[model samples]
Target: MVEYALMLAIIVGIGWLIYNQTQLSDKINSVFNNAGNLMNDAASKSAKPPTT
Candidate 1:
């Protein structure tokens, strides 16, 4: 009985961790995408002809 209780606790803990990580992963992806967009914008501006 105790072993079953312990197993349940561990499973719940792992599931919670996975849920948190999924949320965190999405945030990380958005941040990386924003950084990539900023880099692309900078490159586009730099590639333009120099002003007089």
Candidate 2:
């Protein structure tokens, strides 16, 4: 009975840790994507032919 409870606790703790890590990775990915898009936009704008 005690072994079962300990196993359950360990499983729950591992699942929570995995969830938090995934969330953090997603947030970091979003930030990098936004930064990359901004850089691309700036580069494209600078490369456009100037209008008379």
Candidate 3:
């Protein structure tokens, strides 16, 4: 009985960690995408010819 309880606790902990990581992963992906967009915009502006 004790062994079974320990196994259950370990499984639950792993599941909770995975769920939290999934949420965090989404946030991290958003940050990276926003950074990429900003970089692209800067590059495009710099590539244009300057107006006299």
Candidate 4:
């Protein structure tokens, strides 16, 4: 009855939280990955000797 409904609601809320967290983590990972790649490219370019 009411208990069943409560349990269902709880389960749904937990599932939503997990789904949201996963999406957020994926976005964070991509941002950091892009930043790391950009930094690496800059570093490599700077290490080379200047050309006339």
After superposition of all CA atoms, the RMSD between model 3 and the true structure is: 6.2
Question: Positional deviation of 9 in candidate 2, in angstroms?
Answer: 21
**Candidate 4, residue 19: how far the Cα is off, in Å:** 6.8
Task: Extract clashing residue pairs from model 3.
Answer: none
Question: In candidate 1, where is summed lDDT lowest over 10 consecutive residues?
Answer: 19-28
Query: Model 2, residue 41: displacement in angstroms?
Result: 0.5
For model 3, how does the per-residue alpha-carbon lDDT over 1-52 read when each residue is reduced to its tens digit? 9999999999999988987978977888999999999999999999999999
lDDT of 4 by residue, 1-52 (tens): 9999999999999988997978977888999999999999999999999999
Candidate 1 global TM-score: 0.58
Best by TM-score: 3
Q: In model 1, which residue pairs have backbone atoms overlapping below 3 Å? A: none
**What ranges in model 2 sit over 4 Å off?**
1-22
Instruction: Please report how far candidate 2 places residue 3 from its true position, in Å.
Output: 31
RMSD of each: 6.2, 7.0, 6.2, 7.1
lDDT of 2 by residue, 1-52 (tens): 9999999999999988987978977888999999999999999999999999
Q: What is the lDDT of residue 37 in candidate 2?
A: 100
